[model samples]
Target: MSALANAPFYVTTSGGYLLVLAIILPAVAVLAMLLVPPRHVARIAFAVMAAGLAVALVIVAELVGTGMALAYVVGGWQPPLGLALRADGLSAAMLAMTAVVICATGLFARFHQCLEPETQDGRAATTFWPLLMAIWSALNAIFVGEDLFTLYVALELLTFAAVPLVCLDGRAETIAAALRYLMFALLGSLLYLLGAALLYGVFGALDIHSLSRLDGGAPAVTVALGLMIAGLLAKAALFPLHLWLPPAHAGAPAAASAVLSALVIKAPVFLILRLVLDVAPSSAGPLAGQIFIGQILIGQILAVLGASSILFCSVMAFRQQRLKLMIAYSTVAQIGYLFIVFPLAAGTETLPAWGTIAWTGGALQLVSHALAKAAMFMAAGAVAEAFGHDRISDLGGFGRILPISALAFGLAGLSLMGLPPSGGFIAKCLLLTAAVTGGHPWLAATILAGGLLAGGYVFRIVDRALATPAVELVARRPIPRRLEAVALVLALAAVGVGFVPLQPFGFLQLGRPAVSAMVAP
Candidate 1:
């Protein structure tokens, strides 16, 4: 159920067509790949990617210019029967960011997947184009979908598309990793379905806005919310359930890793946030110290899980000997920062959660991590491609061979370590401020501790890059400068995000349910 479920549905708005184009254009490109020869697949894919990027930008501009969410109801029918697609400020922002990362990954992959002289028309290259488009389509669908069941369908599409990308190389280990990912995803899907069914059975509606009108203290509603969130946590790979992540992400090609880390996992998290704050009753007058679910305060629970994720996974990231594995682990650690927003953004008597500094910080963290992690993965991919390995110990003086790639890595690291003039710095600082003001000393300490640990791991790689190795490293093949530029651009975006005003972002608050509207009489 959505927080905006009860709001009036507008059939089509001024910029509504852009949302349709954003979704269908990539899907059309995927179809085009099937008809064209393998050689032209990359061209069509790139063209679609470019158009998709434009559409996403237009959607953002429309939201900003109009200062209202763009909405499209199918065939003049509203939800509970017809599906609706709506893009709020947060959705628009995610759409733009997804387009940028996907485009960058497409460019980087072209060089990374340079056709073999004998196998220039290989299936591997052709398959990647369709898969990429499918992922782009699925991600857009999830962001804009206005109903719970529709989101479930989008999640399934995302999973199916993402699994193939994981094992594109068809190696034994990668195949195993992909299977593991699929298994966990299937379990998550089932749990989510069961929860959705429960919600429909209890409330007679699966629309988020519709669900928000229900009595939050009901037993069925509480159980359904719990089941739904638990399922999403599994999909999000939060801490204890993250076993399938490192292998699947690290085993994928660098381009795939960027998508998986940057966008795929975040979708589940976004849904969880919606479920907690929007669909679940927030003004239910604390039922036995818990309003989120019958027995548990979802915000505090999520914050504790977030803190545990940060402390445990940061150590795991520090101990990884391989570069890609370390980056994958870091992704897990960074996601924890997002969950911490739960407690920090849980509004007091005077303010709304969506208007809180912690909410803005969390959103910034999500976008910045996507940019930084994508850059780091691409840079590491280039290094692995050049040196034939990614062992950190053996990477001594490796920076001399690929200075641009190393520079990209360093810039991304700065964001990860929360250094000034980088998005991570501003995001973490805001979260820290909220924690201190909220009187949550432990969470404040977690923020600092995570940043310090991040610096330690980042320093390990920087040290290796600058040191002299006994055996000089050599490139197995030449890497194009354009490939290097792709990574640098994303890293620069991560840094540039820091320039945003250091306060609660008004843009993100657009389309949020009005406080008066959220409370049941």
Candidate 2:
């Protein structure tokens, strides 16, 4: 029997099985599609995306309704020996975020997601759905896995699935980019796996809770934590470790680019958070590894990197001649926001410590960015589709030709820029307040600076699109009403999250650690 089975919410707690099903169902859908001839691949992929999205919605609704953690036991076995999946507030939030983005990406890909749209049956097109499904599955596995080894497997699965999505077009440059991604990802995986091995050897456990229960006495704990964090940082594409991301993400098909940019790098980040806050003992994390290296200290470092990424990449984003490359740089900048919570929430003296405010902020940032970025990328895809190129300057008067896409892009841009009544604005505001309360001036500065830089980049697009051009853009094909509407809805959703109150919310607190658990009075 599952540990959570006795909880009043177990009937709805299938969040765990729902997680696994979310991951595997798409893979199964892909396999079934493979059996069909080429012409049917797009139809099959769309059908699967439709159903997969519904499953995601069910899980989200249950999470919202129960206001509790959800779980599922694989093989009816519990943790340590039996694999399990669990979703807390943060995880459920992420799941819902991923579902929305993936759904948009699928619709956007229909414009040219296939390998050869004209060929009734072709290799690239058919391979697209399978790869997309694989990526989604890998993402779900990463989110809900309760054990270190399980999460590591999920990480690798995500990497493998994502690498192929980069090179779907079979171009030599894209192939090379994918290979670079594969290699760097492998190095990161090795580091993380090594740490997991060390921890298992020392504690005889891979479950996060069990590992947390171990006395922080072993040298193995320190070394393992270091290795694991370093690995996740690489995959997260943080600062110097981000060598592969720009090319790989930019070169992928637009639909793939949206997913890669919006979601793929996030799995490792979630794992890193788990390793620090869940596995590390409260008294074991310090700068030198003396106490539970409070996630806040590392959070500061993350904030600095985030700030630098925001400032530096915004400039890089501005310089990009290709629309997708610019958006890719914007992605790197947005990711910086996710890392700011560490320093802002590191106080060990308070119940819930500094975790709650920063955690909720980071989750909101992730969700908002996913929705906004996906919409923007899809809009960019629409631009490229209409004009046959993504050169920002050459995108003259695209707003006139593709009004809906331009409108969607602008709304998404509004959220990314942290404008009022948008999720991005609320997320940043919360992080800023947390920084101020926590006395983290550097994090506070980064948050403000990032918003400014984001505004600059967003305005650049809006300005260009709104310009009365010497010549106006014309669509290569009729822009579909359904696709346009979906993109618009997603952009609006990012704005909707802003409606959530600015205070530290109880919803975010629901399953978080109690006041006294991590923070000693």
Candidate 3:
């Protein structure tokens, strides 16, 4: 049977058309926005975000209702010839995250323009709407693509859609940042394509499901895996190769910054996870063992980098003159948390495989970060809008000036700090437990240190935001309730994640690969 025919799901059994709509609506919206006048941009973008979000929600509802993945075949052809899109639990989670972040960004940007056109045509606004739509479509595609070739196309589309968003304002610096982002991402893409080519050459097939089922591995496989992972790490901005991140992310407008930081960088990371867990060979044979060792070794290095980033970046954030810069650095620290899961849960399959706590924690971190970071960035954008600047020290107080925005910022900070009843806290707690149980002292230490640093940095902004503006900081445009409320909802969602059962969620394992072949010891 074709892979599409075997897909698992939750709601209605429909999968193909919904996936098509999820990808199409965004592209169509982008085109429509491009054709509309600037003044009509916000309305058009809002309508698109609403519709896109609805599509995303339906995908989850369907997935949950059927308790299986939904699948759609392109051109009515099966895999190995035609392409298929499958939304498994992981993809559904990612899809939901993308929808939330994109929707929030649209709402936040409704109050401002990146660079409105000079004419009545509103060309810039029109242009941005479509680009945003294009980006949403690309992200969804990346999450759902079942074939390596299909995924490669999705990654490229994501890159093309995203790079332009960085320079939407058309300023010289923003343009420079966008170019740097573009060049680095292209390099990453080259590496990924090289690996994909090698895979096709070896297996004569580029479908992940097919490859994993075939259990292919060897010198060529290792080499291809290395190239692909290296490429994705650079794309995801894992330290050392992360030279392009802060500038590109921090330089973008607030709404844009939120989406870029909270969502875009994650695409490559998601790909890496798929390669390692689903594609890479997992055995104790010299070659297979070597690959696992490499992953664990790299995971440890990443944990250290994450710890240092939290410490150093938090201090740097504290010293920042601009609020946006501080948040940008915080993005670095948050990225670190994603890596910690590597060392903690990525060992040999010994002693029940460190249980499922670590696995669940990592997924939690990814999702929660999406919600908290998106909300925080939107909140920060509101602060800048109200005060005309993000000067941390000078903006003595914003709580009095924009209560709702400040509150949203504070709530988001709570999650980032890993406080109780917040998803960040639940995520960290699970990771820490896993580290201790796995007997990884360093990983445990790093988790604690990261949390502490996060606390220090998050405090710096809240202090200023609540300080009661020295002279009653007046609102620039009366603190848009709609925008602030959007941020608030996101923050609440992050906190609610903490309420999810602490144990490993079966939903995450709906279609899990058999660990029998991969287990160590």
Candidate 4:
């Protein structure tokens, strides 16, 4: 039987067209921007943003209403040959998160540009719209793409679109940072392509569903998986390979920083999750001992790296003086929590990885970090815009001048610091519980240490915000309340995620049953 026949859920669903619309809408906007005059670019982008967000929402609604995954087979050809697009509960969540962040970023960028009316149609403004739309298109594609090669294409588009955003201001340092980012990203792409080529040579297929159905214990499979995971780690900016992130994120415009930190880095992490869970062999049956050893090695290695990232980077963040740099370092620290989930969520004889508390905790951390980090970046942008600099020590009494921005930053920090009644708190709490239950005490301690370090860095800023300056801080330029409100809304969303029941989320398990069944004995 063909792979599609064997895997029944691979068939297209009634609402599958929405997945195409989610991806194509933003791409069409990019093409439309090319045809329109420079002054009309932002308008076209705005319309597309609204439509794209609607499509994302409709897709989420479709998944919830039908209670099944959405799938579309491109050109009516089954996988291992033709392409497929699928949106499970996870993909739908990513799509919605992407839409919300991208739309907020669009508004934040528009408002920031409007502050200088004469330059509204200038090079930066004109370039930002098309690139932003391209990024949105790329993110949507990454979330839904089922073929490994297709995902690589989306990653390339994401990297190319993001590089220019980093250097939008044309400053010497920003240009250098963009070049560094481009070099690292291209290197990652090359490694990923090499791995995909190796996999195709061995299995004669690069489709995830097809690969998942086959035995994966061959030597070539091991090498290919390792290369691909390493490549994704570079793209995700996990510690030790994160040299390119701080400068690039710190140099980008605030809106671009929000997208890069909050969304762009997530695509690779998502792919890595798919690869480890979907393509790796099950630790059961005849080869159970070998497979179990391999799984432990991989999971433990990732967990150790994650622990290092959380502790080391949190300290780095605490030491940084510039507001954006501190947040950039904190992004790396927050990402560590996701990696630690691998070991904690390792499936047992009966339970699947997706059904674990650690899995839910990791997903919540990803979504909450995206919202909270984006809000923090936007708030920092407003601070820099008002005071003309981002040196935290120099911004004493900034809260007295930009009270709304200060409040937004503090609220966002609540999530980052893993404080009560915040999404970060629940996520970390679940992770801690899993670590303790799973007998991983060191991981639990690392989580606690990371949270404490995050609190320290966050408190440093709050202190500056409340401090009394010898000469009261003054705005170099007036910032509108609307721009500040955008950040506040996202911060609230991050906190709102904490209200979800503290159990394994059923929504995340929507399309995972087939894969879980295949992996089980």
Say which candidate scores most in TM-score: 4
Tell me the spans in candidate 3 whose CA falls farther than 4 Å from its real position.
1-13, 36-41, 113-121, 215-217, 282-288, 347-355, 468-472, 514-521
For 1-521, candidate 1 gives per-residue lDDT tens digits of: 44344566556897888888888898899899999989999999889998999999989888878888998877877766777888988888889989999999998888777724455458876798899999999999989888899999999999999999999989999999999999989999888999999888876767775665555436766777788888888889898888999999999989999999999999999998888776775325445245644423777788888899899999999999999999999999999999999889886444667879998999999999999999999999999988889999999998898888889999999999899889999999999999999899999999999999999999999889888989988888888888888999999999999988653298887777666754534
TM-score, one value per model: 0.95, 0.91, 0.90, 0.97
The global Cα lDDT (0 to 1) of model 2 is: 0.76
- What TM-score, to 2 decimals, does candidate 1 have? 0.95
Compose the digit string of candidate 2's lDDT tens values, residues 1-521: 12233342222254556777787787787788768877777787878788778887887677778877777777776556777677776777777788778877777666554323564356776687778887888888887778899888889989988999999889999999999999989999999999999988886668765665555444677678878988888888877677788899888877788899889988888887777777765324332355544444455566777778777887788788888888888888888777766656564555453356777788788888888888888788777766778888887677887888889888988788888888888888888888888777877877787788778877788888888998666677776766677678888888888887644366555556576755432
- Lowest lDDT block of 10, candidate 1: 287-296
**lDDT of candidate 4?**
0.90
Which digits, one per residue and each the tens of the lDDT, describe model 4 over residues 460-488? 99999999889878899889999999999
In terms of lDDT, model 3 sits at 0.76
Q: What C-alpha lDDT values do all the predictions have? A: 0.86, 0.76, 0.76, 0.90
Which candidate number would show the highest lDDT if scored against the true structure? 4
Clashes of 3: 18
- Evaluated at residue 282, the lDDT of candidate 1 is 38
**Model 2 clash number:** 16
lDDT order of candidates, top first: 4, 1, 3, 2
Our tally of clashes for model 4 stands at 0
